[model samples]
Target chain A: MSATNRQIRLAARPVGEVDPEDWEHCAGPVDEPGPGRFAGRTRAISLDPAMRGWLDDRPSYLPPVGIGEVMRAGSVIEVTASDHPDFQPGDHVVGTFGVQEYVVSDGRGAMKIDTSLAPPSTYLGALGMPGMTAYFGLLDVGALKDGETVVVSGAAGAVGTIAGQIAKAKGCRVVGIAGGPEKCAMLTDELGFDAAIDYRADDVRKALRRHAPDGIDVYFDNVGGDILDAALTRLAMHARVVVCGAISQYNNDTPVKGPSNYLSLLVRRARMEGFVVFDYADRYAQAARDIAAWIADGRIKVKEHIVQGSVDDFPETLQMLFRGENVGKLVLELV
Target chain B: MSATNRQIRLAARPVGEVDPEDWEHCAGPVDEPGPGRFAGRTRAISLDPAMRGWLDDRPSYLPPVGIGEVMRAGSVIEVTASDHPDFQPGDHVVGTFGVQEYVVSDGRGAMKIDTSLAPPSTYLGALGMPGMTAYFGLLDVGALKDGETVVVSGAAGAVGTIAGQIAKAKGCRVVGIAGGPEKCAMLTDELGFDAAIDYRADDVRKALRRHAPDGIDVYFDNVGGDILDAALTRLAMHARVVVCGAISQYNNDTPVKGPSNYLSLLVRRARMEGFVVFDYADRYAQAARDIAAWIADGRIKVKEHIVQGSVDDFPETLQMLFRGENVGKLVLELV
Candidate 1:
């Protein structure tokens, strides 16, 4: 075990695209587990689009990570030392463990994750918050019905990938909107998406109209702005737009574009609802059980783009999400 | 009865503010009632903010009124002749009778209104489409709850006036935002609103923060530009924004200013839902009955701005809606 813990801290709030200067890499003495406390070494870290929102100094589902603080993150940590009754050494846990080599917890928000069923990285992907976000955002907020035509933007990303697969598993026709040819191919060929539109190459509105010929009944929008506008224009009657995240507008220096075509809600008698996954904490266990079963049954496919480096690699790994370089669940595995 | 029908026809689509050239004053032979038809002389015509949306050539809840066609309107008509099974001569009815001195209808969307209960102008105002819009938009779309903080824009206008009163009737704390001091006074004093914000004088966001200190639960947005943005900023957890109309953007020569703060929906885990009253056509009867009871019980005050004029005055009367001159429901009464 390392005598010192290396941590990446927020140096400044990001403006438009996040810069390297916005983060600081520092090392501190590793804390010994005291009474009712547990210390863990981070094995895998989750890189999420929502992290960008947390960096902004504004009110959201969670308060922004203040400057000079260890950056807030969702990570799979292996308990190396423990004094807490509930958490034992050798047990793996998942929680808002900051971007650091080690984490100390009171076991408040941390949940012991079983790695025997799946790998540690899988806990950061399909069995984690992104998985739960896709689940509740689709089923609960969207009120998805069987045989409904579903469209998802940012379809190659973490939540989008799982959301599309879940829609397909539930007997819905799924059309995915992604960026490149590679990502689009991966969506259709590997992820079982019925159709995938490369948003970079095709006219999204036209492609959506062709793919979702019957009009979209459930639009799981992770990318807001123009794509959201396109989805709005093609909504079926009583469509439910699940606003999980808006990655497209997160890094914008200008104002986030509100969907001008929102009036489509009135025309189609539809609804648009935004949700936070933390709101569904009580049902996470059932959702995880269902997701695990689907994974075992081959109805869901898990994808991870793991960057191997120290905690210092986080800034670059996060940038991959905004650049649309990562294929699925982007993660940082400490080496 | 008049020998010729004096009609207002759509001459051209308005660019920004509606101009006199957008309408054509024409005279046509008054059609006699044929089989299963009724002919009626217009008693009072409804002038609505929604009329602005109908003039634009766009896909909305209803199709845009075509050039050279009689401008579509809702009016109270006194039946002069009838071969229709549902109607008889001397019966007063309400329907999409168009901007004309006389109308012949097959009773498709027409409902016979009793003037003994309320005046003809009231049917075009408080007891008509505007009334139904407030009822359903507030209760159904807004999903209003008692004790919730409700804020309404265009609070002195037709739908806004009725919506504020209905929210008050349902035991909600209501705050109204209107353009002028006179209109604002009407909202608080006559309409039973808890507070009123004169948007012209007060900084709307500051006023909203002052009035709804705890945060707003239901926001009934009628005038949708900056005021909508202000309301978005004050949304509480799980807020419901009822987008009944956007009169502020209806006449814009440029693109409509989509609320810049719409991301507030995501931050607050809220919803912004648009609704057209016509979509609730099946339930309008029940809603009307409830509204009538409220009016009879003095829980809801009816406000109407009646203009005594010919059908040709419609172009000028309609302008009153955009100018924010009328205090309540603006109607043109043919005397």
Candidate 2:
């Protein structure tokens, strides 16, 4: 076990796109598992677009990460020491453990995972927060019906990939919108998407009209902007627009561009709803089971973009999400 | 009855605001009621913000008014002659009978109204389409709960007045937003809104924060634009934004200004939904009963801006709605 731990702390609030100056890399004494607690070494850290929202001094589902604090993150860690009865040495756990080499938890929000079922990185990606987010946001908030046509923005990303696949599993026709032709091809060729629109190459509104001639019944939005406006113009009657995340607008210095064509909701009698995944904490186990079954049956494919690096790479690695440089779930795997 | 029926027809589609040149004032021979049909003299016409949408060539809840056609309008008419068994000469009926001195109908979409309970103009205001719009849009689409904080835009207009009063009748704290001080005052003093914000005089966001300090549970949006954006910033968790109309953007030559702060919906876990009141047709009678009782018990006050004029006045009277010149319901009553 390492005698010291490396950590990345928030140095300052970012104005627009995050800068290296905003993060401070430092060393700290590794925490010991005190009474009723367990200590673990982080194996993988999740890089999510939603993390950008936590950097600003504003109100959100979760409080902003304060300056001089270890940045908040979801990670999978392997237990090295324990003073708790439920947790033992070598047990893998998933929790909001911050951007650090190690973690000490009292089992408040930590869940032990079976590494034999899937690797630790999978827990941080397909079997973890992103998985639960796609499940609930697409099924519950979206109110998706079988055989309905679905259009998902940021389809090459974490939640979008899972959401699109879930819709396919439910017998729906799914169309994906991503930045590049390679990502678009991966969506249709590998992920079972019926069609894919390279937003960089196609007029999205015209492409949507051609791909979804009947109109989009459910639009799982991960990247909001003109793509959202495009999806709005093609909504079927009583369509559901699930507000997942806005990766495209996360790094903007100006205000997030609202959907100009949102009034189409009135003409089509549709609705747009937003939600946080933590709200469905009670049902996570059931959703995990369902997702596991889909993966086993070959209906769902796990996609991860793993970057082998130290804790110092987190700030730079996170920028890749906003730039659309990574495909599927972006993760940092410590060697 | 006059041998010539005076009519207003759509001349050319207006680019921005409807100009005088967009209307054609003409006279036509009054047609007799055919088999199983009825004819009536137009008594009062309802001037609505939705009329502007009908002038634009776009897909909407209803089709646009074609050129050279009698401009479509909702009005109350007194039956002068009938070949239909359900109608009588002295009975008063309401329907989309267009902007004309006389109307010939097959009795389709026509509802017999009781003038003994209310005046003919009142049927075009408080007991008509606008009234039903408020009833369904607020209670159904808004999912309003008793004692909740409700914010309504365009609160002195037809639907706004009824919506504010209905929220007040349900024991909710209602904040109204209107253009001028008089309209704002009328909302609080006469219509029973708890507070009022004059958008023209006060900073709307600040006013909303002061009035709905705990956050707005339901926002019934009649005017979408900056006011909608302001309401969005003050939403409580699980808030419902009922998209009823966008009178503020109806006549804009530029694209409708989207609510820039709409991502507040995600932070607050809220929803914005739109509906056409016609979808709730089966429940109109029940809602009308509730609204009528509230009015009778003095929990609701009816305010009308009646312009006594001939069919030639239709074009000018509609401008009052867009200019925010009239309070409560704006109606053109034929002499």
For each prediction in turn, the share of the native Cα contacts (below 8 Å between chains A and B) that it retains comes to 0.54, 0.72
User: Clash pairs of candidate 1?
Assistant: none
Give the TM-score of chain B in candidate 2. 0.98
Measured against the native two-chain assembly using Cα atoms, what DockQ does each of the candidate structures obtain, in the order listed?
0.67, 0.82
Clashing residue pairs found in predicted model 2: none
lDDT of 2 by residue, B1-335 (tens): 55899999999999999999999999999999989999999999989999999999999999999999999999999999999999989889999999999999998889999999988877877778888999999888998999999999999999999999999889999999998888888888777788999999999999999999999999999999988998999999999999999998998999988888888888898999999988988888897788788889998788999999999999888998898999989999998
Model 2 reproduced share of reference interface contacts: 0.72
Question: For residues A1-335, could you state the per-residue lDDT of candidate 1 as single tens digits?
Answer: 55789999999998999999999999988998889999999999989998999999887879899999999999989998999999999999999899999999999999898889988788888899889999999999999999999999999999999999999999999999999999999999999999999988999999988999989999999998889999999999889888888899999999888887777887787888888888999999999999999999999999889899889899999999999999889989998
RMSD, every candidate, angstroms: 1.3, 1.2
Q: Please state the CAPRI-style docking class of candidate 2.
A: high
